[model samples]
Target chain A: MSRKRSRNIFIATCITPAIMLFALFMVVPTFEVFRMSLYNWGGLSGNKTFIGFNNFKVLWNDMRFIQSFQNSVLLIVLVAVLTIVVAIFFASVLTKEKVFATNFFRIVFYIPNILSVVIIAGIFSAVYNPRTGLLNSILGLLNLEQLQRQWLGNQDIVIYSLAGALVWQAIGYYMVMYMSGMASIPESYYEAASLEGAGKFKQFSAITLPLIWNNLRTTLTFYIISTINLSFLLVTAMTGGGPDGSTEVFLSYMYSQAYSNSTYGYGMAIGVVVFTFSFVLAAVVSRITKREVLEF
Target chain B: MKETKRINTDTLYKVFIYVALITLAITIIIPVAWVFMASIKENQEFYGNPWALPQGIHFENFREAFVEAGMGDYFLNSIIVTSLALVFLLVLALPAAYVLSRFEFVGSKFINGFIKAGLFINVSYITVPIFLMLLGWDQSLRQIFDSGFFLNNLSVLALIYAVTALPFTIFLLSSYFETLPSDFEEAANIDGAGYFRTMFSIMLPMAKPSIIIVILFNFLLFWNEYILALTLIPGDKKTLPVGLLNLLAADRAAVNYGPMYAGMVIVMLPTLILYIIVQKRLTQGMTVGGVKG
Candidate 1:
């Protein structure tokens, strides 16, 4: 065989398994998810009993599904905004030369991001535990008992409490991201802004925010996705979407229906909704955030 | 007078920034310390004083978590699944990345774009179908082997983990490969290196650092994975996160707070140690993927 012919064959040989595996696991199964969403099957077994979008229609009127969808969007917004704000604040500070132990602080901040969701949930639950939990105990110790309340059990505040945990876990990762973003900017921009008599706040809005706009937009997209999906693990761990379903999220709702409640078709329908909603949200956020890059 | 006022303002701003940063830092650090303290405390001590120092070392908590609460089993299960799955992912991604980056072929761009689209696929959205597919695998495996029930679950779990990881893996590594100079491949080809030999000897070795980064990304991913492991892997074969949940959920009846905390510690320690050790590389790998994506 010609060397070129053999080389082409070699490339094909090298490439086929990945394509096959990718198709089997991702492409084929994704198509399967959409197809199955139209049926009324219990699971893999028994008759599928085609219902043709009945599952989607039920999801439309499903209160639990609707509530969970709202909760997910709420989480996406809260986590995206809070994490970005906190991360930017810390990253901006750490990027400045005046900050002490930036390395130490950076590593410390990212620590929670590295830890398991289960562990973070454990810590959060302990803090939120009503009777002798840390938050209540600390409030009691400070003689501020009136401020203390059931953190996880109160339906009104439960999602917020869970969002707090998610933000806490996420800040470090986003901080590192913003840190990298800040690192790439020319230091001269900050110096010029300062020389122009722009104060700290003004310099941040002018120099820091504008330069980091690209990273911020990307981070916003990431935040939307993570807040929606990452909440699955955290919600499962901390509240299991509990205290009267206040914390129910798209994934947990789907999880319970598919596995716990054995309505795989309904669950798959919810999955399609979640998949569509988040992508649209991400696209909208990213588009709205798009701006002319301030090349330094 | 203006300069002095400016200096004072600068100091004030610094103080405000430091104070805000310090307070937030404490918020992150204290909870972890509390978990560690709780792990070593006696059950009553934990209930009585959540923040108190353990009266003694309580070396038994680790043992209790490992042996009694059976975190050891879950740890073993996670280690086996994550490591094997990472190996599987690398095996799939390396050559695919190599081909996509190097060879010109019809439909390659389409394939490459398809892989990129997979990045946006939230695996949870498709969990129902994926779960059913695993059930199908189980049925087929049982009928064929007439035994080895957990085999399909384990195999399917590994595949799922690898597949979920593929988009990022291929994207990152293909970019890495694209950045490489053609000199090495050209040199090997001129030296009469066969195709497989050239890829294995020259290209693969050169891609080592990128490969390591891919492995770290997938390793961290599979280690902390919860949802799939929760759905697919059954009772005793639960991965660490899922197993920790099971342990904590059952702890109400068990009332074994010390061991429960220890299990939490156990679940977190590997990734913690890993982050500390390869702190730079871990952050770089994850951020590279993040920033690039």
Candidate 2:
């Protein structure tokens, strides 16, 4: 055989399997989500009908979807703000300060990130249990029993409860991300700022912040995407959108509509919205947070 | 006089930092350590103070979790699925990543862009469609075989796990491959090594550090993955996380707490041990490509 022919054949052999599998599993199914949204396909019923955006029209009036939309937005904002502040604080401390046992704290903080969301759900369920929970019991011991309430059982507070778990799991991962960014900042920048009589807070805002602004901006997008995904997973495992659908996020509602309600069409419509929503949100966030990249 | 005030304020600042750091550390450590303590506590002890230590070692919860709650079988299933998925992922990803990054081939750029776009495709949205597609295949196969094949099959589940992981794995591996000096391949070619021979004996071995990172990350991913395992396997064959979810539900309904906590430990222990051993590498691996699912 010719040498060129042999090279072409080798390339084909190497990439064909991965491409085929990617198309079949990842590409086709993703396409199917969009296409199926335009049809009324009832799962397990062996009937699929073309509906032409009627599913989306129905979703417009879906009170449950709207509630889930609100819940998801609340979670996205709460988790992003809380996790970012706490994580950046801890990351700066561990990176800049000569704290004792810095390695121990870094390793311990990341423990929650390594475990399954299911395990986190289980842990928080124990922490949030009303009569026998760690949180309430601690309150009791501190003589602040009036502050204790049904952490997961109260409708007014359950969404916040989910937010807390998400923030807890997320802080370490983003902390480490920021720390890596912080670690890369040249120390000369900080020394110069200190020479100008900059306090710790001033130096952080002026020097440490802008140098890592690109990393911070990138994590803003991550915060949105991961918060959406994790809130669903945690809701699935912990609350199942429970105590009367109080904690239902986007994907959990989509999942219930798909499986529990058996309305595959409606579920796919929800999926399409979420997919577009995330992309748009990320783009808007990235646009708003855009800054001139700094070279150190 | 001014120096004394500055020293006092500096001391106060140091004290404040310590308090904040220790508070965050305790928040994380106490819950995990409490779970370990709770896993060994007797049933009666759980009714008392949540802060109280376990009175004595009670290993029976683990026995119940492993045997009665079926975590033992689920653990074995997880081992099989995770290992199989990793093997499939590396086999498929390494070659594709190798050729795509190193060689100039037709459609390579388009293929690269296509795979890069797959990074935005989260599994949560596509899961139901994949489930339906598998169900459709199973239905077609049932005509001839008188049974189903795609759904509830461990190998098929493993294949899906690997496939879903392709974008990230290939993206990471491709970047690593792009850094290699082409002179190694040039020298190998002059010595009469074919493409496969060079990749297998020369290029792949040099990629060992990255291959380890891929395995470690994906192992945790596949082991802890539950939604796909839950939906795809509607039957008895379940991964560790899905099984633990079931056990949690059942035990919660029955008000059985000890076995539930034990099940949590069972699901998390492997990942924890693995994390502790390779955490430095794992966190460092994050900055390369820096995407999370």
Candidate 3:
């Protein structure tokens, strides 16, 4: 065979399987998500009608959908804020201070990340069980029985309960991420700051924070996307959007509408909105948090 | 006097840091250790105080979870699916990543762009559509073959897992591939190694660190994955996580809490063991490719 011909064959042989599988599974279905949204398709039936934007029209009025949207936004904000704060603090301390058994803490922190969301759901179910739960029992032991309440049962507190689980799962991953970024900052900068009589907080604010601002901004986008995705996964396992849809998040509701309810088109519509929402949110966040790249 | 006062506050700050760290640590440790303790606890021990230690080691819960709840079968299913998906993923991703990173072909940039776009397509979004598509294909197959094959098949599920995982796998592998100098390929060519020979013998072996990282990361992902497993396999055949989910639901309704926690342990123990073994590599490799689904 000619070299050029063989080269063409090699490339073809190398790329075809991956691209074909990807095109079949990933690309086509993603397009189907967009295409199916335009149809009024019911489950397992040949009753798909071309209903343009009408599914979305109904979605606007869906109180359950609205509730899910609220829950999702609430989760995104809460998980992102809580995880980022705690992760950054721990990341800073672990990287900077001389803490005892830092490796042990890091290892333990990441345990939640490795376990399945289903496991987390089970763990929290135990932790949140109203009668014999760890939380309530602990509160009782601490002589704070008044603080004991339904951790997952009450509609008012369930979303926060879910958020707490998510934040727990997320902090370790993000902390590791931030720690890597923080670890890369030159130590000389910190030494100079300390030499100039700058306290630890000032050194963090001046040297570490500004230096890792770009990393933080990037993770903010990650926080948004993963939080949206994970909230759905957790809700599916934990609550199944329980207590009259109080804990329903975006994808969980979409899963119910599409998969369970067999309202395929409606579910796809929710997917469309979520996809666009995440993209726009990430873009806006990236823009607002954009700072000139710091050179250290 | 000044130095003593300064040291006092400094010591206090250190103590405060320790307290904060220990507080967070306990919050994490207690719940997980609680699960482990609960897993071995007898059914009656779950009644009074969750904080109470198990009166005795109740191995029955694990047996029930393993045999009765079908977690044993699901554990096998998870192992099969995870390993198959990793195999399929590496086979597909490695060559594509190598060619894309090294070779300049027609539409390579566009293919790269396409894969980049695929990164944004989260599995949750297209899961229903994928299910529907497979269901449609199954409907067609049933017309001829008299049975459905697409849904509920482990290999097909594994394939889909690999396909959905392609973009990230490709992205991570290609980034690693792009770092290699052209001299290796040229040397291979001088040694009469053709493209496939070069990739197999030279380039691929060189990508071992990356390959290991990919396997480690995707093993956890595929093992822990349930949403796709739950949606795709809407049958008795289930992965561990889905089985655990069912156990959670069943045990909740039946109030058989022992088996439920046992199921949780069954599902998570492998990942935990794996994490403990390669945690340093896992966390270090995580920075190489940031976001995972």
Candidate 4:
């Protein structure tokens, strides 16, 4: 009995510090943010007026907030679809033994995955810098100067450019996921399909796709969450929610409001909105993708 | 038995596969090659012959990036923050994961779910609030530790990274510990080893692979992290990402692409090398962990 008590104590002691830290740092602050959303605070001042949802009311009516939310949604859709499609395509191609220099190709592609967003943003900025950018320079050499346009500064095409950069960064990660899924597929399934005269394409369609449905679903979930979360860094570096807020996503806009604009209450309200949106998105994805476990 | 026709068709398919794969490889390599070429070229050469190889290898850009841009400090800061955070994450997460995985107790499910739910809270969503909290702490704590406590900025950033890494670390380690046989632990317990002893002496050594995975994941995540570090750490203690941003701002008008590219090359090399070294383990680890979810 004494031994069991000591064991329990040890476990409790081991977990307490972490739990405390997490509670203090993550949970408490999260709740505080929620509470602060109800007030009109200027930040760093004692003059926090009790607004009671006025900030949220402002948030609801704010055009920038609404547009950023839409942009966030659009970004999530574009990045998620592109990443999955590109990843699966690469995964399928790389799995074949006949594919020459598979390891070399894998290494080349994975380079972008490991790069910091700052570096990627820098690289793309150089490549897209209107005057001497590689793209414009190439077009100039081809005597197609009229075709060249400002990639980052151009409001209309900026979002697509940002998406392109994101896809470039993210595709390698999803490819790793898909390749692993493909690797786990049983060889016997392929053998059976081959015996029945199923070609590679048909086999992939019927066998591999269905088999890796779980991975696909998980990748989709990761894509959505990360797209919403991490893409802010790229957006900040590349555009700064710029060319008149055309590329503003929720996170960047919230950042500007809080740090730059000093609209603390409004920023907290946006945070709440972001939290609620993410929670709903996650719950919905999980529900839609939920399936009974496949016994292999 | 009709195997001859099958062989011929297989050969044809092989040719088609190679063609498709080479195209994919070219697409992947082109951008990287472009960056490498630009990094070595002069600004004039870049504009004049963008696609051509550099007229001369300009290795001085690397020096300028390190010394002039103060990327040396940034690199050191990144290393310190990432390493410290990784250590803290592993230390806290391992035991927590162990407890949650090995023992079923009151609130265990809730605790596990709580930690896992953190994965959904998009780090960006919490960044503002967390930054405000840190700012408050910094202001208060500054009086207690004097100016020396400024180094605690790294600790604060590390704490955040460690917390953020908790969900994935716990989730991965729990699955790993679940797969470990209970018999070894039971035997150790029967032989007068306390739970801590059994866990450390028996289970930990066995769980080395999972530990490595945890370390690698935490390392990569913290290393690449920008927003958290940017918000938390002020000037003079800037990490690589923030340093790069500063460099960009300082050079935006001058348009010196050479040193900027060199800085990028420096920042990217560590992660690129680490990725290559651990590519196999990373692929397998993420696949197993990801699929389980």
Among these predictions, the greatest DockQ belongs to: 3
- TM-score of the candidate numbered 1? 0.96
- Among residues 3 or more apart in sequence or in different chains, the pairs in candidate 2 whose N, CA or C atoms overlap within 3 Å are none
lDDT of 4 by residue, B38-149 (tens): 6777767755656777889998787888998999988998999999898889788888888888888778888888877765555676777777776666667767865434
Return the TM-score for each candidate structure.
0.96, 0.99, 0.99, 0.91
Q: Write the per-residue lDDT of candidate 4 for residues A197-266, one digit (tens) a residue.
A: 8888899898888888887887777776778766788888777888899999988988898877877888
Candidate 1 chain A worst ten-residue window by lDDT: A39-48
Instruction: Show model 1 residue runs off by greater than 4 Å.
Output: B148-152, B291-293
- Span of ten consecutive residues with least summed lDDT in model 1 chain B: B147-156
Considering only chain B, report the TM-score of model 2.
0.98
Per-residue CA lDDT of model 1 for B1-293, tens digit only, reads: 99999899889888998898888889888888888888888877866766677898786888987887778888888888898898889888898899898887889889999989998877777665666676776678878887545432566688779978888889999989999999998898899998899888888999888888888767777898887788776556777888788778887557778888888888888888888888888877776677321
Report the error of model 3 at residue A75, Å: 0.8
How many angstroms is residue A211 displaced in model 4 relative to the true structure, after the best TM-score fit?
A: 2.4
- The residue-level lDDT of candidate 2 at A83 comes to 89
lDDT of 2: 0.93
| Model 3 steric clash pairs | none
Task: Kindly list the per-residue Cα lDDT of model 2 for residues B269-291, writing each as its tens digit.
Answer: 99999999999998889788778
Task: Give the Å shift of residue B239 in candidate 4.
Answer: 0.8
Candidate 3's residue-wise lDDT over A127-241, tens digit each? 8889998888889889998899998889999999999999989989999999999999988998988899998889989999999998899898888889889999999999999
Model 1 lDDT tens row, A158-267? 88888999899898888888888888888888888888988788988888899889988888878878887779878888788887888999989988887788877777
What value does the lDDT take at residue A124 in candidate 3? 91
Ranking by lDDT: 2, 3, 1, 4
